[model samples]
Target: MRKNFAVIGLGRFGGSICRTLSDEGFEVLAIDKNEERVNAYAMIASHAAVGDTTDEAVLKSLGIRNFDHVIVAIGDDIQSSILTTLILKELGVNHITVKAQNDYHEKVLVKIGADKVVHPERDMGRRIANNMASSSVLDYLELSDEHSIVEIVANSKISGHTIIDLDIRKKYGLNIVAIKRGMDIIVSPKANEDIRANDVLIVIGTDEDIDRFERKVMQ
Candidate 1:
């Protein structure tokens, strides 16, 4: 069965999640204190309501805890965000994801039993910086503060060499998880598989080791 989702706050981040989840065929309840914001998403989300999420009575009336997953994306209002998250936890919501405005906000959310905390702006900035810093890096996904997965295009320096010949795991402490060539993708490529120029390598490793590999092999 598809999971039911509830998104509190119809701001940019929350609206995007609501729309995407609806497009993917998930039932989503979009809520916001502003009637206009809720009205705007009425057609896009499975259900839309205007209510003060920080108020326990309002949240209970809306049946907020019934959803399988709840995303608290209140923008700028740190108090409302924290209060709403705390109420959701007390109500026994299965999963609660909150957007943190800063490090301190994240700490408080974690302390209040938020299942997940995200800093969209901070993460996006890092992703953009990582892509700009490397000419061959096409994409970057941060798994944590210390590790990441990057898609890098093979160049002359690393092309035509087999995985075993390059000894990527031993030398750089990175793994070539997959290779994307044109329309096809090779998953868990063999050690003897030859890498060709223009192939997109899906590499995973610690951030420090990934940087070393990129500088030593790609450049």
Candidate 2:
């Protein structure tokens, strides 16, 4: 069954989520206090409403608890964000993901039982920095502060060598989880599998280990 989703506060973050989820065929209910904002997504979402989610009565009236997941992407108003999250928790919403304005806001959301807290701006900055830092690193996904999964483009230096020959696990303490060659993806590539120039290596390891791999093998 397709899971239902409700997004509160139709700002950039919430509006993006609503549009993407709707495009992906998920039933999304977009809510915001701003009438104009609500009207903007009316044709995009499964349903869009103009109402303040901070009020328990408003939430209950909208059947917010019936949705499988709720995303609180309230911007600027930290107090309203917290209040909305608390009401959702009290209403027994199954899964709640919230966008935190800062470290302090993240802590408060976590304490209030938000299932997940995302710092979009901080994360995007890290991703952009990583891509700019290395010509070989095509993309970066932060698994944790200390660990990450990176997609590194294979260069001539690393090409024509098999996984075992490179000794990545022993030398860099990293795992080449997948190799993307053109449109094909090889998952858990065998140790003897040969790597070619331009193959996108999907690797997972500690940040330091990945950096070491980049400096040694990618260069």
Candidate 3:
């Protein structure tokens, strides 16, 4: 079954989520205290409303509990964010995801039963820093504080070498989960598979090990 979603606060973060979910064919209800923001999403969302979500009556009236998941993306207003999440929990909303401003805000949201908390700004900063640190790195995803999955372009130095010849797993302590070559994606490439120049390697490892591999091989 398709899940119904309600996104409270129509700032850049919440607006992006609403649009993406709607584009993916999910039913999304967009809400904001500002009438202008609500009107802007009226044609984009399944429903759009200008109402204070912190008010229990407003939430109940909107039938918020019936939605499968709720996203609280209130920007800068930590108190309103926390209050809305608390009300959603009290109303027995099945899943609640919130955008947190800082560590303290995240802790409070989690304590109040938020199913997920996202730090978009902080995460994006880390991703950008990783990309800038290595020219070969095409993209980066942080699995944890110490572990990451990065897409790295194979340079001439590592080209024409087979997985077995490179002994990447043993030498770098990293796993090449997949290889993106042109339009083809080789998942769990065989040991004899040769890596060509410009092939994107999807590698996962600890940050320390990945940095070592990038310096020694990619450089």
Candidate 4:
């Protein structure tokens, strides 16, 4: 079944979610207090409405609780964001994801029953910093506070070595889940497979282990 999604607040964060969900063939209701913002998304979203989500009556009128998932992406207005999330929780929405402005906002949202709280800005900054920290690191994704998945270009030091010869799992406590060379990708590469310079290794491990691997091998 196609999931019904409602995104409150039609700013950059909310607008992106509405557009992406719509692009993915989901039914998205884009809501905002600003008529201009609502009208902007009318053609792009399954439905668009102009209403202040902080108003309980407005939320009920829109049948927001019936949606499978609701994203509260109110920007700048922390009060409205918190109030809307609180109202959604009380109305028994199955899932509620809120965009928090800061750590304090995240804490409050979690306390008020938000199913997930995202700090997009902080997370993006961390990803960018990690990519810049190592020349070989192509991309990074944080799985948790302690663990991450990273794509790193194989350097000359690790090139021509087989997985068993490198003993990466024992030496660095990291696992190479996949290897991408040009357009070809090898998933769960065999121990005898040889690594070539410039091969992109999709590795997963604790952040500490990944950093150590980057410093000792990638450098």
The candidate 4 region of ten consecutive residues with least summed lDDT is 124-133
Whole-model alpha-carbon lDDT for candidate 2: 0.86
How many clashes show up per model?
Answer: 0, 0, 0, 0
> Worst lDDT window (10 residues) for model 3?
124-133
> What are the per-residue Cα lDDT tens digits for candidate 3 across 1-219?
667889999998788678756654568899999999999999999999999999999999999999998989899999999999999999999989888999999999999999988887864434643443457999988898689999999999889999889998999999999999999999999999999999999999987788778878886
Candidate 2 per-residue lDDT, tens place, 166-200, comes to 99999899999999999999999999999998999
Taken over the whole model, the C-alpha lDDT of each candidate is 0.87, 0.86, 0.87, 0.86
Q: Tell me model 4's lDDT, rounded to 2 decimals.
A: 0.86
State candidate 1's TM-score.
0.60
lDDT of 1 by residue, 187-207 (tens): 999999999999999999997
| Alpha carbon deviation, residue 148, candidate 2 (Å) | 17
- Over 4 Å off, model 2: 123-219
Backbone clash total, candidate 4: 0
Model 1 residue 104 distance off true place after TM-score fit, in angstroms = 0.4
- TM-score: model 4 vs. ground truth: 0.60
User: Which of the predicted structures, 1 or 4, would earn the higher lDDT when compared with the native?
Assistant: 1
| Candidate 4 structure quality by residue, lDDT tens digits, 32-103 | 999999999999999999999989999999999899889888999999999999999999999998889999
TM-score of each: 0.60, 0.60, 0.60, 0.60
